[model samples]
Target: MKSRIHPVSRPVVFRDRAADSAFLARSTVDSAKFTEWEDGNTYPVVDVEISSESHPFYTGRARVLDTAGRVERFERRYGGAVRPLR
Candidate 1:
């Protein structure tokens, strides 16, 4: 392996505040925030909005879309002039 060419990898903590969970992993990214892990070690912490913990697919919580209501509103506004594509 070449030396002094690749980005250095360090142990960092990825925190998912929405799910109230965190995990330690090695990455090249760094953060100003720091946190203590369960293993009794302090590492740089990065706040993430979504992860496997809170994701819809992983958590099996899909968002229900209001498709029918939207279609009715569009038709009422445009007088249903927009015909369906053949």
Candidate 2:
């Protein structure tokens, strides 16, 4: 047991830049930015690149990437399934 071992969790806002969305929740994360929330109170704001709002899995827009024919190149380099020697 220790005194004040846990960080303080306060009302914080997490902003999703890609999706242009924001949400408020309790967090201990620190931020230098502040924004006036819908309730007319200023809270610490943390900007994030992606969240459930814009994530492919959450948005049901998942995509498969075949960059520069890498998969094809690999297949051509090592054709067919590889079996181990007995």
Candidate 3:
């Protein structure tokens, strides 16, 4: 362990705008904004676009990609130039 060489880790609030969720956690990330938490204390507010609350995988709403269709489209456009592997 070293002194005066480590980042300051403190409680910060991560806000997920899409899911409207906010939580407090300790992090070393820096932010210029602040907000009062539920405990009536001010903490740095970090706005995030995606979190567990808003992530498609966590919410079980992930979209399945049609790989076959995409491959077919690519082949249609560039199949003539690409030589078949033997």
Candidate 4:
């Protein structure tokens, strides 16, 4: 390992704006804003729009596509073509 060549890996707080959720983890990413952590040391803080806490998939709020309804509507609007199944 080379000294002074690699970015410092330290505890960082990732804040989710929409959900107002925050979590501390170690990362090498750089940021301008800093905050004092639980250890009484200042670390960079990164603001993000989405995280696992607020993501639809993780939260089980993901929308299921209405394919059946769409197909029916399409067939009703435009006559269904008869094509041989492959």
What TM-score do all the candidates reach, one by one?
Answer: 0.69, 0.74, 0.72, 0.69
lDDT of candidate 4 over 1-86, digit per residue (tens):
88899888888999899898888999998899987777887889999999999999999999999999998897888765755599
Best by TM-score: 2
- Colliding pairs, model 1: none
**lDDT for 83 (candidate 2):** 58
Q: How much does each candidate deviate from the true structure in C-alpha RMSD?
A: 3.5, 4.0, 2.9, 3.3
Which candidate order results from sorting by lDDT in descending order?
3, 2, 1, 4
Q: Write the per-residue lDDT of candidate 3 for residues 1-86, one digit (tens) a residue.
A: 99999999999999999999999999999899999999999999999998999999999999999999999999999988998899
Regions of model 2 farther than 4 Å from truth = 64-81, 84-86
Model 1 error, position 75 (Å): 16
lDDT pick, better of 2 and 4: 2
Judged by lDDT against the true structure, how good is candidate 1? 0.92
Residue ranges of candidate 1 with Cα displaced over 4 Å = 63-86
